[model samples]
Target: MFVGHGLGAFALVAFLATVAGCSRERAIQLGIVAGLFAFVPDVDIVYAPIGLLARSVQTVSPDVFWGTANTVHRGATHSIVIGAILAAAVAAWNIPARVSRIAAVGGFLSIIAIGAVVDGLVNAGVLVVYVATGLAIGEWARRKRSSTGWLFGAALIGLVSHPFGDLFTGGPADFLYPFDIVLVTSRIALHPDPTVHLLAVFLLELGTIWLAIVAYTRLQRISIRRLLRPRAVAGSGYAAAVFVIPTPTIHTAPLFVFSILALAIVGVGIPAHPFARHRRSETLVTGLAAVTVGAIAYAAAYGTLG
Candidate 1:
């Protein structure tokens, strides 16, 4: 859910919106908005920097990337109701285009600022001042129209999608602000969780990646095979690496993961022929990738874990 939230998530959403109505080029532009806004909710992490330099940090963790102000990681902006409000506001107002530009800039800076906190590289109240300055300037921009549907759509997609991405990584999103309602509850355990049952989460991420690829490629008239190749190669390659890695202690049986992976690869091949008509290479590559996943999972099972 790391890159899944940023690049893959926003891009996939942008691609889908493009297919919905807007022109491809316009959709791409809106995608820029989606990508930026997707990170906006996390901007509150700026408080992490403010606290550290002031030596009176408002947040407990100071782990800005995951920290929040006066509350938890998923705060107000992460709220669905809040996001809806923001999105609606974006649609309803004819604000200066610069507001978005500065917001996007600040949003990314905020992420970087959070990273700095995580790395412990920040001090002297400098980072706090820096981000604050940027945001402040962004707020003072010039204004335009509310008739365009693009802003609303982009805002809605970006704002709403951000929380769902968090579900696969951390706690559930608080969709209803001030009501204490958790919109998403299941954060299916995965590898990083220090558990043996990593298959479910891994498969979920794999499936998410696949969905993004399939949906976007189809929408853009890009052959699905085009997107699948590199992924298969990469998966197969990683499988190869894992298959040869040194063993670790307390490994759990990953046979099921491998078996399912192998089956999935062959499945990809079967579907390719009907879709692309005699595209044997596509099936072969996919099948090979599947074998790779199977091989990796099988070997990994015997390697290490709790």
Candidate 2:
């Protein structure tokens, strides 16, 4: 899901940019900027280490560690209001240097101030890191000389779309933070059965990654379908895992995830020739296709048996 966030943003923005008449190189650059910004909200995960270090016992289970660390995971950073402000600040970088500095500083401080008022100083400290990350990405876009409108659009789309993706996996994000409004109260259920729901989400994530891959190939003027190999079909064998592993839910999915992902080994059977120009790319495309096939096969088996 973490990688899905960045890649999803990249795919959407890059495709839109291409359709909007941007040069291929310019579209790719804008997409990269948006993809980076899409990762800013999750920076709250950084709190995991700090929490672990402060504990009397050094070790904790995965659930305990994540629970402790994610206290502020979907807070102010996910807010559309906050995202808009950051986008504006980033876009301002195209203006005079002094005004740009003022906008960036002012936007950063304003977010911290809101966080302090709403969630307390500790969470506000987290906001500081988050704001810095957004600004750093904005600065990078500025250096790339991205147009003001394009920069703002990329930032806004990337930051804002992130929260929606979360709704499908866990608790809803605070879409309107510091305002005491709850837009969504629960995770969006894709299926009635827990195992099926988890599988659905997993397939959705794989689809997103594939979309990003297609977008990349388009930018490089390559045909993704042609790069894939017959070995990918071997992934269908993963359906056998349905009979062996315990049923998986969103909360307990490591076994299912790991087992299905192991099918990626099928992609390694590439040309051994040293002079094969597209060998690396072919292997990667083949691997992704394998994983995609495996997940679908597993889902179909689970649906039939369970």
Top candidate on lDDT is: 2
Tens-digit lDDT string for candidate 2 (143-175): 888888999899999999899999878889989
Best by TM-score: 2
Worst 10 residues of 2 by lDDT: 270-279
lDDT of 1 at 182: 61
In the range 114-195, model 1's lDDT, one tens digit per residue, is: 4355434532133344334323322321122213366666666767788777765567766675455665566635455333
Which residue window of length 10 is worst by lDDT in model 1?
A: 137-146
The models' CA-based lDDT, in order, is: 0.51, 0.86
What's every prediction's RMSD, in angstroms?
A: 10.4, 1.9
**CA error at residue 42 for candidate 2, angstroms:** 0.3
- Per-model TM-score on C-alpha atoms: 0.52, 0.94
Candidate 1 lands at a TM-score of 0.52
